[model samples]
Target: MNAGPISATAAATRAAARQLLRIVIVGHVDHGKSTLVGRLFHDTGSLPDGKFEAIRKMCERRGMPFEWAFLMDAMQAERDQGITIDTAQIWFKTEKRDYTIIDAPGHKEFLKNMITGAAQSDAAVLVIDATEGVQEQSRRHGYLLHLLGVRQIAVAVNKMDAVGYREDVFTKIEAEYRDYLASIGVTPTFVVPVSAREGDNIATRSQAMEWYDGPTVVGALDSFQLPATSVDRPLRFPIQDVYKFDDRRILAGRIESGRLHVGDELMFSPSNNTARVKSIEVWPEPSDSDARPNTVGAGQCIGITLDDQLFVERGEMASHTTNPPVETEVFRAKLFWLGRKPLEKGKIYKMKIGTGEAQVTVQEIEHVLDTTDLSSSTTSKVERNQVGEVVLRSRRMLALDEHTRNGRTGRFVLIDGYDIAGGGIISMEGYADQRQLVTQRAKNITRVQHGVPTDERERQNGHKGGVLWFTGLSGAGKSTLATKLERALFDRGYQTYVLDGDNIRFGLNANLGFSPEERAENIRRVGEVAALFSRAGLLTITAFISPYQSDRERARKAAGEHFHEVYIKADLGTCEERDPKGLYAKARTGEIKDFTGISAPYEAPDTAELIIDTSNLSIDQALEELLGYVEKTFRS
Candidate 1:
């Protein structure tokens, strides 16, 4: 008999069954993670025909007990070492859908491999030895999963047969692990007691655990829904490379998120250059009969030609102007350190984010996290295999997103010399997105030309006008140096004035708060006023913490050649020891929010005109050097 036509609902269900889900299985060493995956493949009849028999024969020839972990541990080194050293991926299926099971290594030495596996998975299965309950590695694995943004998790308490399948034992293990996972903001979907060796509670309900009423492992696996597709998110096409082919310049990259179509306007970030997509191109050009695709979504690797000949380069991110990625030089990060040496503050490392690379310094280490107990402590360094909250500063602006916003563009790795030292997720917790602040918004305003020429003013004053912008951490002696320098310049009959931070805030910027945006605006206003003073043939001295490099750059642009960046350098420990204003104490006591060198970030100048190290130099010595430099440069 011929079959009838399939209904729409049945056809949709069949299509859904073909969809693939990637799952990473992680746990402590010898916790049966590999065994669980092997058993799942066997129970579902998804293994190759002779694969199972070959494994049994090998075990018999070696005079060893038949083991399920051997099914996934395929490497000769793994078999000899009796441990999985790398991430093993295999395909398996149930009646409902297909799955890619990634068996991640659980040994502490191979945790980086596990992290790589978990990073590519949509869901996770955390295995635990029932006898061991929750080990330190178990808690560490759970925290790593959370850090990788794996929310859909199932905990399989293996080795139940070792404990005689006791209901209290299972309950105790489940309760302890559940509490630990909850502490790190991870609530597992289901906690099932399973004996992978005997196939209990793995593919079917276990008869031995009669008191247990939760779904089996297979049932829980089928219950997880796929995460939202990247195509639904905003467009983030980072230019990996630029290919010049004949007459066309093809911008090649994978669409990290969102969609791109022919004629769509693309705004390249960090550069802020715009262009229109002229045509989409693919390799092995289609025939005349085959219509070329006009649109492409996330995950597709394609190239496109633009309408204009723009100087686009590698490391530029393409996005819609309405929803561009956050442009910033400094951002907060939650880092997982894996380096042999501890990650220390003020140390420079190469950061790879998206397709771009930049040199970033560890501006501050907020705290080192104890993953096992979910406790945090203030620290100056993050040790190997530890996690910490850090603030990283880059010299140039980076186009990125917060991890919660877009995982693909939000993750990055730090390279120490040649090895991968750490990986982290970006967060703009206390930082501002500087896109709007940096972009020019004012329109149609004309500058009033001064009647007096600058040279004429210089002739009258016997010296050229200039700005000495002193920037550093609090207690770095910026105000002290600025006041003394002003007095010395006055004694020499040179016109000079000091614009201290407190004095400016008392009047011109009193309405502005200490928020990142307000701080940028405050510096902006002070920079303009200082520029006016310099234009009037007077040396202007401004003393402020002015933490962000971008703000300082703006001030330099406003003053042109007259701007001189003077870095009053002092180590944080020395500044705290001085604590001249008692502000550092207030910041430590939680009385001040967004305090630089305490809770906030302070980006030291990379190419300052002069650096005065107050930590080592006496007040008189620093002042003499400063006065000599000013006289030699500004005096005609």
Candidate 2:
């Protein structure tokens, strides 16, 4: 019996799927990249019928040489210009694996398009013209490939025919390029010499290069390894959209890392919301033989309905509670700037990563790097196409991981107006803390006390000592109430001290500014001083517009159980009217930066022990009420 004729579609479907590898070809312009890709497709028998003949006929009509590059120059503009202006991806297959070849443009003006191509690739073939040796864009593309985290690379010293296929020419260019790649930590799998135009040593070994012995281009590609699956790592599913189809609200997105199973509880970060997976929904339902239909691994896109209708948006990432990503606003990152304009401090840009977008500012430029030689220079601005280390501060907190730990959540791109201005990887997470340094330094120092015990001092003072931390708007009467209470306690023959905001800034916190990190440090120092006074058996009263809740929590931890948060209640309108020093007017006109209650944020205490509405009450009445409570709590 004879088999019937099979259609092209049927043959393709019947063929078993091979291990997939996405490969990108990059180098300087006119380096025969397209010719190499065309040759690979033709020699591997991956081209369809009449495709090669069509390109050859077109070349003849145009009175041009029969070159394989014409096969890839499918676009009319590219065929006429003889240069790839955009990225072109074509799928081909070898016996061992299926490959997606991404031909990235080498022109300097089209580097952004090249980045888009390289970012999706698992490996790369960096082609260099043997006659040209090494060019400017060759080094740059190499650097970018390393930055994109494409570790598997193979160097193709192309256009070997132009150099007369000399063994020394191949050896010289190979040695120089290899040394440069090593400097940037890229180890090429193989360095092969080939004539892309002549189809020599692409799919099969070439006899023209008798002196050289290495894997052919096809063999080199097969040797490149695929990235390991991240399913064993913690789950990081960034929700793209909430879809409601046929009576179910399904959260839809590709699982970026780790595995997701039915009945597993997940905590969404930055928002800190929890939900349980009800079922893994697929487009085409799986068969009964498919084990665990409610489970999915990394790289799979699926929709899932939760047991609880938890409010989750596109930006919130679903992470396992056991190991969740860090939630922070200020982080240190290493990035390359491709914006036409230089990246300057204080200028805001939009950052987008995974499923989240937020306004971001370059808080500080630590250093600029010379990408060619890996040299560092102290600079305040990152110029066009320059790599730099900077501290990026976002308007809102984001759940992010270190690039080394999870590449999906760690990589981000900066948008300047309409275009993607830059891209980066998170290096470190968290803001600067000089106080932490001081704490680490104090570890070796010994404890010392000069006078009577705290109990004896409190007994003699006729009160139990504690700290009263007054937090509110700048002109909300926190300072006025603290001063009045201090005098009232002193008149009653009790030990008391006031740490006024402006008074302490004049000396102790003189060097600190009003930035978020600086404000935290200022509060940290004041909290320590107030704690020391409390230990000395004196009631310590702190009056400051401590805005952030995190900073206040630090103060509470420092002052122990005796610490009391007193929120002096007053709206922004009332506080601005009572601005005695005319600071509100100055802040409104942009004369003062990071001014709480005017420009910056002022987070009111959520669970304050005391709430005093100073707007309605007179100073004397407010003080009398506060005094009564303090005396009752501390009376001996």
Candidate 3:
């Protein structure tokens, strides 16, 4: 593409054509969100011409104190407490772009304010405290922005003056925080040093910081080459309202991702819905045919008229014809559980994903991640504001995509009963539970199992095969109790089978080995067979050193509500002394891999009904108590 040398009139027209971009400043409390925004307005002269005088007069009238930040701190309590409680959208202009800057509050308690601001922004200026470095909420805000899919980031390391403007200090903090950002997958475009309160290196270049050399605050702002969404992505129009005025039913919404055009064939994924453009319009008419729809994307308000009445409601999306939308009920999500209570598994919660809302249950918690260090070498229940990957199954399906693939479909908010407590982004499309799909993929291969005549199995023992789970450390005497319990149940007219590790490995589980994942798979297989046994009405007793709580949880879920979970609790010292099989000795000597008793993760279950401590109780005593409970609970 070529253009002739610009005329003065054309250049002036080009300047006038620059659309205002919304930028939001967000960070933890006292981390410079307000001070930075205040400085920007001060530098841009966006405040009244007599700004301090205007503030002074306002304060004088109210008999209150005032500061430069008072220009935007319009709330009485905000001034009184010296903390922002809500997002403030203030308009200002630089030499190049007219801007709307959203100042987001950073207190951990005011995350809603942060979200409100982030929701409206095209880009973000992530503020970090230099002296304190990255705190919990600092990492949290970064993670939230990443979850919200905000791409461009400019990190402002505030309070440089506090640390004596050490370039090394700023450099170190910048590097550390930048590494943190990249872990959650964001690369901040720029890291600028400035003392927001003292105005050093903010609006004006500071000579006091002699070694530091980069764009001054104004320079960075003026030099930013704003990228348009039309050049980057496809058209996306989310229907926000359905309006009918003067017999015209118009679909009104913001062009959230890409440009809209007249006669464009659009498909809405979530509704399994599609539509073709009839007319593209704004309130005022445009002269150019190409600009008739005003050549817009990613922040323009327009009304779309369709060829057919699809009866689309608010929250549905409109995309290009070539790219069909996603329809999904379950997706793998990278979630930050922000509720006061830990994210419990199997409970239903409302998920507001993009424009789609559904009741979603946490199918599984994949891993719990540390926000500060980004370590995920462990898995557990997620606490408040703890980021993790959770697989969710929804009561109702909706259009969806992974966060890496599409920001809109990927983003979701978790609702706890009536409250919106957490939010996250779908990171992966969850696989259909493959066990259920196995036969279909295998040319509809029918499962052919030779039946052991139910009567013969009953003759071999007595009742049905059901799982009797025994959980404890390696040397906890679980096997002894399980052995006795199985014998007791066997004597009581039950078709009983014992699945101890040694017994299992010699036959059905011979192919399995030691590793957390392998052990989990082993437990899973055992649990499955136990269910089959239970279905045949045979009593099954299984004892394994399964260390992971997730594995145990899956075992319980797999085996059904009737499955018995017997926790054989024994102290390490007591178990070591009794080491019947000498397995704990081998494990301690490093002869075993992922040894539960020596080197592995353990998640103790909270609701295990029967806990028999063999350290205090002998094998007979534990078995007596367990069998007694089982008989009392299940025997008719």
**Which candidate gets the maximum lDDT versus the true structure?**
1
lDDT of 3 by residue, 99-176 (tens): 667888888788876876786677888888888987888887887788677778788889999999888998898888
Give stretches of model 3 more than 4 Å off.
1-16, 58-66, 182-185, 225-232, 239-254, 260-262, 271-275, 279-315, 377-380, 429-636
For TM-score, the strongest prediction is: 1
Best of the two (2, 3) by lDDT: 2
TM of each candidate vs. truth:
0.83, 0.69, 0.60
What is candidate 3's TM-score against the reference?
Answer: 0.60
- Model 1, runs deviating above 4 Å: 1-17, 374-381, 437-453, 462-464, 468-515, 541-545, 564-599, 603-636
| lDDT (0 to 1) per candidate | 0.90, 0.84, 0.72
Query: Lowest summed lDDT over 10 consecutive residues: which window, candidate 3?
Result: 430-439
lDDT at residue 7 of model 2 (Cα atoms): 61
lDDT of 2 by residue, 129-159 (tens): 9999988788888888888788899999999
lDDT of 1 by residue, 268-334 (tens): 9888878899998877668862466899999888898999999988899999887899999989999
Pairs of colliding residues, candidate 1 = none
- Reference-based lDDT, residue 593, model 3: 52
| All candidates in order of TM-score, best leading | 1, 2, 3
In model 1, what lDDT does residue 420 have?
A: 95
lDDT of 1 at 457: 96
Evaluate model 3: give its lDDT.
0.72
